[model samples]
Target chain A: MRFRRWILPGILVIALAITGVWGYNQYKIKKNYETTMQNSYQRMFYDLKDHVENVQVSLSKVLLADSQEQNVILLSQIMQQAYLAEEKLAQLPISHKDTAKTEKFLNQVSDYSYALASNVLEGSPMDQDQKDALLKLQNYTDYLSQELMGVHNKLTEGVFNIGEIKRKEKEDIENANDNMLNVRLVKLEDKMTKSPELIYDGPFSDQVLSGKAKGLGDKKVDIEEAKKIAQEFTGAENTESIEVIEEGEQMDKTAWIPSYTFSIPKESSPEDSPIYIGVSKTGGKVVWMENSRAVNKPKISVEQAIEKGQKYLVEKGYESMESNYSLQYDGLVLINFAYKQNDVTIYTDLIKVKVALDTGDIVGMDAAQYLKAHHDRNIRQPELTQSEARGKVKTDFDVDSARLAIIPKEGAKEYLCYEFKGTYQGGDFIVYVDAITGKEVKILKIIKDENGTLTF
Target chain B: MKKAVLILSMAMLVTLSATGYYLYINNQNQNNFSSTTEGINSVEVSNAEKNKDGVEESETVNATLAPKVLYWGSTGQDVKDVQWKLAQWDYYNGAVDGIYGTETYRAVRAFQSKNGLGVDGVVGPETAAALGLNFGPVDGGTQGAGTTAISRNDDIYLLARAVHAEARGEPYIGKVAVAAVILNRVENPSFPNTIASVIYQPLAFTAVADGQINLSPDADSLKAARDAINGWDPTYGCRYYWNPATSTSKWIWSRQVVIKYGKHWFGN
Candidate 1:
């Protein structure tokens, strides 16, 4: 009797203890779930807001393009993004009726924006009415973006306690360590220094530093080592002397980077181990360095690269020749050439590249490669007379002007062509025709409708 | 015998009391959980409503609702097919994914921008979108989902095309937006405008910023195009649109709202 009594008491105590533990665990689980859910929702909201911002940016581009083609393409893209953003927002399943209503409003805004773009591209006539509508649409989208920004800020500040729906989610946090926003811009004062046509100007040069590189490692440049390496490459005094002008960071927390400026002899070339060496400041190791490959004998000069580009085309039989127009992109030179064949004048662009003046080596050639790779193409000469070609223009089009020029065709031939531009059929049209054969070669049409006016 | 019975009854009473306590706590927890879930749903709904309030004014502003039907190109047939194709790519924003709506127009523009097409936002020949290629025609098993279908290589090509289309005709910023538009379409439902679909829409993007979509896209273009598509978007909610030159589009005035970015305005 005593044993039975004791066993029953013990069982009662155990059961109570188990219940208490279970209750605590449940509380903890619920709390955890709430946190995760809240976080995920907030992030999703921010993502949606960001997407809306992107749509505004795209539409802005359409408004700014100068070419008819650019405007059309940009308009199309704006409409696409606007609707997509609306759909994304709609999928959130936010239970608040007010929020759903707001989403619907945004959707309507997107629809309006898309409609304008479509009408404009369709050659619809543009009047003050359309302009006024576009202005309103533009303003509304901006307001929406601003409003969303406000919401995002509030969420970030914990203004809304979405604690019940909290849940953990994997996030792709941008590693703050991977920033090199301290790069600076410097002019290459020395002619012998040889600046590359394509410069790797890091984000730092533009002052677009977001300070996102928290806990980032120092720049990946070994100042002392890079100076030493630079001396060897430039044949400077002491073969290790370098003046550090600036320092920077790159690839997150991995390295320290620095930029140096110096004056080397005019005869210095990339013939040595390295003319210039970029090193990692953190580890005092080299990350990048240039070698002697850029240096060659009188193998190719800037002028020679241009000549070669032209000659390459000539070898393929393109005649009516001229010269390179100008140089750009640091070391890139644009060559303009003309040739006459079969009573026609052909104009073409030839691009030539010289890595550095100090090395006199050709680094790239374009026009020649293009001509060689693409053989003379067969083309059907237009058969319409100038009058007939002009007649093909719509009646509403008004003739602005006309010109006669020699045009080059792909078959190593030239043709006398007439270029006519006018407003026809209530739209602008630019037409090209063969003067000798009186055939229509090309036609560009620009339409003006309620949506807007297009210019070619 | 009486004392033993008393002890047994007392034990039974204790057991009953403990069981009752356990049940009470369990019921309380369930109630809390259900209440919290309801609260979460309510919160989400409220937040969404708050988000949409800003664009409410523009829809009724000029309100010149035109015919919804669109003539995408000369024959209109290409636009129809392209719209359906875009639907497959998940860019369809309307009923058939084929019926061109305001959303479809936006997606077409984004595609043009990605493929170096003209910024006219139309699916004209010069803005020839990319043509779908059969990788299998050259090598079997070389292309598949997540493997060859619009992979990094294609991204680069599309990016280059966007650069050509947007940057060539407009300022560099416009080109970036053009790039962003393509990227936006990749995430939007109104466009057949997957990063790949919009790019390969076939003659839909001819004036790629370079006035030639025929230019072989470079690796940088592909990557940038993809990045723009995946990264920062410029057309999130904006549906109606206009460039400054075409600011006179009456349809735009019909839209009372405005969302500004860089140099253009997007909204109804």
Candidate 2:
């Protein structure tokens, strides 16, 4: 009896001790992880500060430099430092809201410097206006660098815990605005917003940043008209009801095509699966449509699916569309159809159609690219014949076929080229040669597997 | 004699308790260490569980050292793996019958020669790497539910995992919208240029930070990713999205909210 009593108390004591040890260990582990994460964030912030300082210094040096070669070197340094700074800022834990304009400033600085350097390299002297822009950019970067230094000082002094701020923000977002780092960053953004509007021959130039849709015509369509278009696009017989869900009013007026979004419930579709269609408000044309109904096992072949998609596109008034690439996944085959004009394929005006392999029905369509870039192109006669362009390709390419095509390039440019498709070392490749200059323009390797074919 | 017996039993119980405690502490320490890193340890845990089914521990070590070479007479799952990979590439016309016969040997030789490897019929390290089969002990096997014929590095597969992790509970349109946001960021000059770069940027995506991006995507998420890649901008080029109720950052509220789909508020 004495031993039994002692055994019960002994077991109770051991259980209590175990619980205490486990809880303490867990706490210690959590603390260690938080410290490691905090150290990482600190390191990222310091690197960002250093890069911004380097950009500021380089911008000043570029302004003082006279020789074209010296200016190019300094500008390139500025571009590299600005891009690195932007990348570091993005990796920080700060909210994007506090860093939007700051990030944009860095990107514009990089792009503008790159464009200026290219101009210099091409033997074009820097004009007075470009010099003034560089001076203004330097001033902005100077201010940014100083502000970042202030934040760095506060961080080093442990004015506030960065990790604690992140945790508190997640727990209470409204109260997170009081964080010193966020306040300083917000102030920096305000200053950046006042920076000069930069326009240049670059991808991030103001004009290219606010690109307009060339194909969305200027004819106003009301909600009723848009609903009708959506219903017709989704097949009026299969639609039970269509409701206006949202409008694209929040998009920047110059950058995006405004549209009326609608959700239509199909009569025979599964629960929670509805057909969504976006009709451009300018014209009654359907911008995009998707039916998310689950498709059964594939019964139709990929070729049959492609044929069905082409028929659907024709029925919907997409004429002269030539099917190009097709990829299959999860009981669906997505086919890309590009516009063809006078025996030349226009890759810019593209449409994608997703056909259900189970029933060969058109399940999805995206005409956004078509609606953005489609227009009547002025066909130009090729300076080089098909055989001449084929000669530009490597002799070992083993070319199987060649055709005329127009492909897109950077900075909103398009190149008319003769596309050559063939095999090389058991791999399929598409080579594009400029029809005018016969210069090799671009190369794409086609990767094929049981899933589908894709270009890399 | 009775007292002696009781004392002996008591000593045994104490020893048992001490050993149990020591083991519990060791397991906890390992778990703690692994949790510091993300995504990889979950696979290790599953692998450890799989080893309980009478698999010799030494075999696992061997598998880890190097994948087995399949010769003419090799049979079992490894042979089946070679057959499947060869057939997918149209090198092998024989059945995937888990037997390395004359047809399999010829296919291996052809593949080796075509890929600039030594013209040997044996399926060795170089051949397996070319075929994209690691056969690591942790991977368990080549055939599994999540192991599709599609390359893991494929853009669609990566995007599908992101979509599934970020918006598994969202409606189909919402899933597409999430993918569209990622794509829009890729196009924007302020962000990284590549899809993988943008998705894996530090603290850029909650799914990647939380290790959920390693999960296998369902069919709907895969379809959503494909639709987004095909140029369907359901969010109309919005580059940011967040759940309003759960969003931690106060700065996201300052963004111009473009659309609300399911629980996410997409913004520019």
Candidate 3:
């Protein structure tokens, strides 16, 4: 009887010890994870502060420098630093709403600096208005740097905890607002909204961002018209019941092409996943369409799918679209078709068609790029012959074929070039030489494997 | 005396037969050893030649002769040929000096690894054939079959995982909208430029924080990712998306909701 009593007590004590150890280990693991997360956030915050300071310093140097070379170098530095700062800021644990204006300021600064650097390289100095803009931008960056440094100081002094802020942000928004870092960042963003409206030849320019869809015609289409267009685009035989899911007014009026979205069930099985199609409001053109039905094993080849896609495009009245690079994945083939105008391929006007390899059916199509960029272009005879343009390519590059093409550059600029496809040192490359100036405009490396071909 | 002589002759006959049997077995073993080595050499030669035939369209008489296997410490014209090929392919930086030294060995190993051959730093029949060197017979195994073809791009795979984790319970269009939002973030200057950076940005995605982004995606999620990449923007360039019922941030509510798909609301 005495031994039994001792045995029960011993077992209870051992069980309690095991439970205590397990609880401590769980606590340690959680603590370690929190520490690691905190460390990464702290590192990103410090790097962001550094990049902002560099950008400010570089902007100041550009304003004081008189020599074109020095100014160009300083402006390039500002551009790079600003982009890096933007990248770092995006990586931080902050909401996009709190950093929208700040991010826009950084983007504009980078783009403007790039434009100014290119101008200086092309033998033009910074004009007075440009100098004033740079000075204004420098003042903003200075303020931003000061605010960032203040936050940094607080973080270093333990007045603000990034980990605590993350926890509170997820649990209590009011508590997160009390964090000094969040308060300073919000103030900094408010100040950033007052930055100057920059008008220049760059992508982030207000003029470019506000541009409308060029390919949409002027005639407005009603809901009924749009539904009919969707049915026709998706093939009337396959579409059973079409319903207007969204209207043009529902989307962002400025950023997106105004369109009417329709969901149509398949004729074969109306209960299955339906096909979604978007028809533009102005021209009643099909903006995009997708049928997400699961595809089975592939029975057709890539070439056959390309042919089917081309035929589908022609049936939809998209003529003269030449097949370009294709990617194959998940029993489907997505082919890009560029509009061929007057024997010169217009790369900006791109259309992608996804064909299911199982049934040779055109399952999806996106014409957003084409609708954004397609327009009539004046055909011009090349000043230099193809052979002369070919001379601009590297001598060692083994040229296989050459053709005329129009390629897009930065900020709405397009160039007419002689496109050459060839191999250099056993790797495929595409060289674009300006047909008029005979300058090598661009070089693209083509990466090919069993999956598909891609260009970089 | 006659019986003793008979027993001695019988013993002599047994000894002669045993000696003959031993000689026959020894000669057979020697032949077998030689033939086995020859068999291995022929197999290697044939494998190399098959690869050469796949790479080069025209057959040359030089391929008919067995070529010497080059490795570290090898010298002469064969090493020079390998060095020249590697240099042309930008895999080698050393001088093409007729001698296979440490540099040549490293280059050979790198080439072998990239071409999916045995990475021994030795230019055996397979490596030689991959280099388009004229060596060995012309008909054997399929060439380039050892190189694995990637089925999907890494970005696509990552995007699919994110979609699966975040929108697996939503409709097909909603899943596509989630992927579109990720792609739109990549394009927006306010966010990072790469798909990975945008997806992995600190606390930007709930799936990543909850350890769900590591989950394998279903086929639907992969199709959705590809659809988004193909420019099927169901959300129409909206950069922010959230399930209002689950989202805790008051800031997300401040943004104007542009479109609603399934359980999520998309906004700028």
Candidate 4:
């Protein structure tokens, strides 16, 4: 009793209340963590369902499309959908071993569609076997979409329990979303593996594995020279007054370039916004530049904006650059251009030009990709004649125009191929027939999305 | 009734032990001179002094943290650590493979030559301190823990990632500028106070929207993040930056740009 003056019931009550409150606080923290984790899992499941639906819908659209442009668009949409679905699927409780086939299926869909779309973008035609494969893919996606929607419906109905699903995982029993997932996803993936094997020298091919910027040569320029090149590249009137901000051979160990960065003073507001330009140390060319300022008001149409962008490119000596696509974002219309050499388009040399709708002036232009990839490519003569290449395309393709073109293989290498633009099964496609082997190398289904013409 | 009394006594014992522990910690904190700078260790100092080989101990040791000097022909994590910091600052151009090769030695010499360390190409503790690697685990006591030092590991990682994503290809200073902007925004009234909040704010950074923020931070980005947190405001309180060459946001143009570092122009 001497240990506590208030060794009474009141003291005991106080201590008990404190412990109770502290315990409650701890419990609340635990609850919050659990709820947040479950919510994330729920959100991921919902997103996966949506992406799978999109993949199915895109496949269906591909089946419906009759134009090569629409096929290109559809395939890209499918690729994006497949990638998103794969990402969401990985975030779920399902084991990686259980989902490996599904993941590989998604990967191939994205990679194959991308290769095919690139083939078309370079003006190739799709063969019948590719179309057949696409049709088969469409069927499996249909099955997946419906099954995924059904599972989502069950999730909405509280048919699956999150806690129970986790508990079942301990016993190595299939639970949570596994049954609903494996039932359809595994079958769909299995079907995907049996489809026609597409062997193309796309960016993903092992043969195309190289990270070196082969186009960037040994010529080096100092900062002062780089600054001059920068001012001209940025179209700045005052060359000397433009502040040289930073100069370096490489930004980091991984980056492969020496460049000088410069700042251009604003006319009205010296500090309002900053404009910077990067001139490459090699070949004294502009590598990267950016100008950020809000547009005033919408005054110019997209047509005029395109014209202005092209005009700017032409004036800046981006000779033979053709406007390939346009994307509208915020208040600006960004036009993507590809360089053409000797009547054959080089898709690797891409430049983006952004035109403000309000002023019809070129507000943004990023030539980093172009400068890194562009070089005087000695495009080889195709081993196969246009007619011979056409013969190797999907036998059912209504072959249109075939031409000799060189396209980038894996961003590091170039391959000359015969580009054939045509339609198959009332759906438009471009299938590239390898110039050397007379084999159907790549196929593309084209579609036009909201922003502009894009290939997967 | 006996059980009730026993429970009460146990609770009393717990409360008394808690109070004693609290007081012990509080007393230990007050005993230290200050954490922001080095405090003279009063315990067994004469013995420490005797072991220094006639070298006098520096007064401010806690303020600076640097691992043991890494030398050429030495291959370990420490060498890779300093090499990364050097690479981030544009002093080193070779891969951070942890082997202190000739390139790494040259980089160490350059970094030392610039930082006023001995130009002998050896990465002594002094140079390591400049590189921001810790000499040892910093005490998180009640004394001033140094405002420049970050406490949370995740904050350092997030800040470093933001730097890498936002200014990966920019010059070393540009990476610093990007990190500084985040810190500056943390202080600015209009922006969020936390690094994660300021960085993840919708439309604040293009890297977040583009998912480039997920890229792992290189050594330079990590160092830039550390430098920014350590009160290195290379952007000088500028709140915004964008490459005028690629950004179509005419709205951002209205802000006054203080200066340009690398490809980015910092604006207020």
Candidates 1 and 4 compared by lDDT, better number: 4
User: Candidate 2 recovers what fraction of true contacts?
Assistant: 0.19
Pairs in steric clash, model 3: none
Model 3 lDDT tens row, A249-343 = 34746347777788888778877788888888788899899887766667899989999999999999999998887877666888888899988
lDDT of 1 by residue, A1-456 (tens): 978866755765666566667656666665565565456545556666776787677656655566656765665666556655654443332221123334434444454445455455545533456445555555556666776676566556765543322111011112211211100001101211231111111111111112121111344544456566556543467743353422212222211122232222223553232232333334333222222232222334556655665565454344445442323222222334433344333332222222333344333222321232223424345465557766754565577866554543322234557767776444355666766556565554432211121211
DockQ for all models: 0.01, 0.12, 0.09, 0.02
C-alpha displacement of A339 in model 4, angstroms?
1.9
Question: How big is the RMSD of model 3?
Answer: 21.0
DockQ of 3: 0.09
Q: Worst lDDT window (10 residues) for model 4 chain A?
A: A247-256
Instruction: Tell me which of candidates 1 and 2 scores higher on DockQ.
Output: 2
Candidate 1, position B54, lDDT: 9
Among residues 3 or more apart in sequence or in different chains, the pairs in candidate 2 whose N, CA or C atoms overlap within 3 Å are none
Candidate 2 docking band: incorrect
Cα miss at B30, model 4 (Å)?
Answer: 33
Looking at model 3, residue A65 earns an lDDT score of 93
In model 4, where do residues sit more than 4 Å from their true spots?
Answer: A1-219, A247-254, A395-402, A421-429, A445-447, A454-456, B1-268
Q: Whose TM-score is greatest here?
A: 3
